[model samples]
Target: MSLKSIFAIPFAKLATKKVYKWANKPFQTQEKVFQKLIADAKQTAFGKDHDFENIKTYEDFKKRVKVSDYEGLKPYVDRIVLGEQDVLWPGKPLYFAKTSGTTSGAKYIPITKESMPTHIKAARNALLFYILEKKDASFVDGKMIFLQGNPVLEDKNGIQLGRLSGIVAHFVPNYLLKNRLPSWETNCIEDWDTKVNAIVDETIDENMTVISGIPSWVQMYFEKLIAKTGKPIAEIFPNFNFFVYGGVNFEPYKNKFESLIGKKIDYVELYPASEGFIAYQDSQTAPGMLLQLNSGIFYEFIPATEFYDENPTRISIKEVRLGVNYVIILNTNAGLWGYNIGDTVEFTSLQPYRIKVTGRIKHFISAFGEHVIGKEVEKALKDSIKDTAINISEFTVAPQVNPESGLPYHEWFIEFENEPENLDDFTQKVDDSMQAQNIYYQDLIAGKVLRTLVIRKVKKGGFHEYMKSIGKFGGQNKIPQLSDNRKIADVLQNFLIE
Candidate 1:
């Protein structure tokens, strides 16, 4: 082993021990973080506006500070953008992690100096935990590539602004600089297709061991590597063994990734966002990611069922239960207060506060009151193809409210790597699985209010084409798993199989 890998062994153990201290005392750790956030920000504009000085308990916090989305907090963020100090947090944010927003154009999320290290630390701890569990730090000696946005930043009101991944890119430790791939010039290329091509050229013959990125984008890179080398990724980079990914569910893409790699390798799932590094998979055998209880953020959860209620029930980590679907809320050192990041999660383990991202709060198909979620649909499809040779590249679901034919039904647009022999049988299997999981969907079908769902085959590379058409072909962009309307389905019609 190289000196780096040899040194990583003891460091991994030390880091993981610190993680367990907080993980074992989750409630206490979170309460401490809660107290600190309120105490530190009491003099800031948001803190004062929300009556933080008198907020001594979680009850006081809920009553004084209301749950808010980006729009509700944008007023304070607007002032901060003009270089106002102590508007949200104290002083000014070190940077603004810019991300695409649906209705608000680009969103500028603040990253304070106090909160910045949490991002870096959590990412490092994720790998360190893996090394501790698997007893393997050999990958550290080999080249590592994280397919991320360009590290270039633009100045906005004296604060640097860039994509969250790009901002994080700037903070990569000096020790790993030589091991990271796709040199600076290639990363700065504006177009994704050209960038991927450049990445392929740069790393084609390198001793790459770890490849990380969003799954769909990584698949593109894998395809290019296979095409150019006439070999699976395993053969192209014989040392390649670790895959790191975030942003979306990996179950649907697992089979495709295995096929591309031509072998099963270790995988790590992360739950990082612009707001904070929330969680990461600590063990390969664990059901979900270990929540960062001692991170510079305090957490709250509102039941998904009651999220739309005027007075939704919000609770702290002390009251959360396993298997309940909740919309996660955040109050952080970055100055966000009761902020809804739109993600829905379910607790898999309460002892250490482990959670799995189920879906987005707004990304669901409830047109017929079935309230079908991203997790449900992904599970349904997974169940249908289990123990089979079938492979799916990508998919999305939408309600077909007004069909030309008989009754309205859910439409699943799937891009397949390996199609089932009997399309009708496969469709029926998926429909049956959906019915088994959701009572409302089953009732609708039995009541004759809606017919069984239909699957529309998307042409090869169709999703890629659609993404390119919308100018979001790559770099941290993801297709919503389900939509209430046909906005995506309408555009997908052009790519459907004849």
Candidate 2:
């Protein structure tokens, strides 16, 4: 490791001490953690009943409040974004973290003032972990490149300044401001097309020590780095010490990245969203660094199986189960109440709420960790697909294990507007994409988990028809890009090769 990585480790160790202590010792109950907000929400804010009517026990809060997505909290978010009274979190929110989700589309989530401490804690968690792992906090203390999203300038209302990533950046202490990659303003852009290319050009020769972003965006940057420089990525940013990515799963793309960079730089996976920084990469081998819930947010877990039920069970930090997958629902100090953030998690252990992200409950496959879930497969395909005409409009995956072979096979059905004339080559590319991206799938293919491989090309408009049939075209619910089985998968299954 370099000087920065080694020098900054003690600080990282101190960070571990703080965050681990915080995680291992979360509150006894949700109410105790969120008493202030529950008290505040009782007052009608913007003429809405957002407060706990009589929520006392953790059970009472779980029963009184249902898990919410963006739609469920639209009323609260709409009000808070308009700068109304504090509805969800206490005190005035500094800014909205305008982030994009596959389900909600684009949401400007409010980051309340009280929640700033939580964000700071999570940031410290990531920084601390990087330092501890590298044995060098000064490296991170030096310049770091957070290849993040910029705010959207919306004229819908007069002077609506929206930056999903910027809101988080807005909270960075002035002392750490200079440490940010691409001097806040210098790196941001109105046109993503030009902005991304420029990001590649500027850092091609920089002494970049740390690089962080969502995995999809980061992998794309890697591809761009390779295409433009025509040199291996290590040559592009030789001084780069670590890759810290969050907001999306990186496991599926691990192989592709390893293939590109030649050797693995230290990698950190963070779990931050519009709401707040959820988890960080402290132990390189652990599932995930359990978030410091003292971020002033109340975290609730709904068993993955219970996610869609009228009223499935909800468990608080006090009652979380280890080894079981759960849908993470958050009641952030950021004006979100009983929000189901749509992430599935498994506890590394229950003692301190250490968790590993299993998969989105809505998207995980139980049969074989095929986990062909939406996010995993999406990341896998996004990292794999190098063709433009074959850009997936919609797709879903199902494991059709051959009974005779006693092995599962990944059968994918995809909708594409542009069909390559050489269908065989196109299909091979998809298979290659999967093999190169998912080590498990690659191993399965080598083994029998995939006794065979198949890719089915569905009719151009068929997937849309299936989505329409399900009354889901766009918005909070679109056809999941990957799944165990659905109309899209069934329809496209016939196209797979035996």
Candidate 3:
């Protein structure tokens, strides 16, 4: 065994123990921990302004601090962006992670010193848990090639701003630094296509064992690697055994990614965002990611259906039930109190606190009261094309309300890496799978309230072209799987060849 592998074993064991303690804490002292978090921040300007001094209990904290989206909290955030201290959290943020907005310009999220460890430490524990579970440190013994955004941060006023991956890239440890592929200089390239080519050239001969990125961008990297080497990924990186991915569900791209790699490798799903590192898949045997309860962030769940309610019921960890779709509400150490991050999740397990990311709150098609989310669309597409030779590169679903003719329908725009032999049959299977999964959709069809889903097989690179047109071509910008309205659909039509 390598010297690195020997050290990794002991460290992995310690991380596992720490993660287990944190994962189980919510079952016992979640309320007390939450109260303490609120109490700790009570001296801040926001806490004072919101009357956090009176919040002695969890309910008081909830009642006092109104749940806010980015727009609602923008005024206070503006103060921080302009270099104000003690405005929201206890102190000024270390940096701001800028996330692309759906309808607006850009969202500047804070990454404070207090909250950085919550992200960085959880990321460390995730890998450690993976190492522990695999019973092998060779994965760590080799290099990792992460397809990330520019690590070179931009100065917005006096505060630093960049993509979350870029921010994290700046902090990759010294030991891993030797094993990490594609130097920071290469990662600093803003253009994804240009950066990916540079990454491929740099890491083509490296002893890579791990790959991490948003699935689509990683897929692009893999494709470029294969094109360059004229060999499957396994031939290039024999030690490559593990994959870590997040930002979007990997189910739709699984077959295509596996096909490119030419081997079945273990993968762990992460729930990291500009907001925080929420969770990670801890066990190879388990399906869902274990929610990090002891992370400096406190979490609450409101049922997705009642999310827009004037006083929606917010459930604590102990109060959350299995199988219910809940929109997440976070009260973090970073000063985001009762903030809605706009993602939805469903609990798969309560014992160790595991969850499956259902979808985004905004990225869903509910134009016809059939609230079909990204998760559903992805699952439906997977089921639809499972038996076929179809290899989907990317896809998105949008409602066709007030169509030129006939009943309104869901329109699927797909970019296939490998096209199905029978397109009609493939679309039929998709419609069948969606009907089976979503009752409202099934009912709408049965009642003739909507026509069958329309399938538009776009030319290869259609999704990419559309993203580029919208100035969202690179760096963790994924095609929305489902849009509530026809905004994306109408725009996408301009990119379609047929």
Q: Mark the regions of model 2 whose C-alpha exceeds 4 Å error after superposition.
A: 1-10, 27-31, 44-53, 90-92, 100-105, 151-161, 183-186, 364-410, 413-453, 456-498
How far is each candidate from the true structure, as Cα RMSD in Å? 0.7, 8.2, 1.4
| Tens-digit lDDT track of model 3 for 141-247 | 78888787888889977788988888998888888888887887898888888998899988998889999988888888898899888999999999988799988
> What lDDT does candidate 2 reach at residue 16?
73
Model 2: residue 498 alpha-carbon error in angstroms: 18
Query: Which candidate has the highest lDDT of all?
Result: 1
True lDDT of residue 410, candidate 1:
97
- lDDT tens digits by residue: candidate 2, 1-498: 445446456656776787666565677444556786576666546214533667666666665677778888787767666666555555456666555555667776776567767766677667676656655554644566676556334532322446556546666666566666665454567454456677777776666767777654565577678988787777776767678776545554555566677677778777767676777666766666665566767888877766778878777777776767778888766667778777787778555666666556656543565444454566555645553434444556776644445556676676554555776666666677666755766777776556545567777556546655554432113344455555456654444333
Give residue 337's lDDT in candidate 2 (0 to 100): 77
What TM-score does each of the candidates earn? Answer: 0.99, 0.72, 0.97
Give the Cα-based TM-score of candidate 1 against the true structure.
0.99
Q: lDDT for each of the candidates?
A: 0.93, 0.63, 0.85
Question: How good is model 2 by TM-score?
Answer: 0.72
Ranking by TM-score: 1, 3, 2
Alpha-carbon error at 199 in model 1, in Å?
0.3
Candidate 2: RMSD to truth: 8.2
- Prediction-by-prediction clash tally: 0, 19, 0
What ranges in model 1 sit over 4 Å off? Answer: none
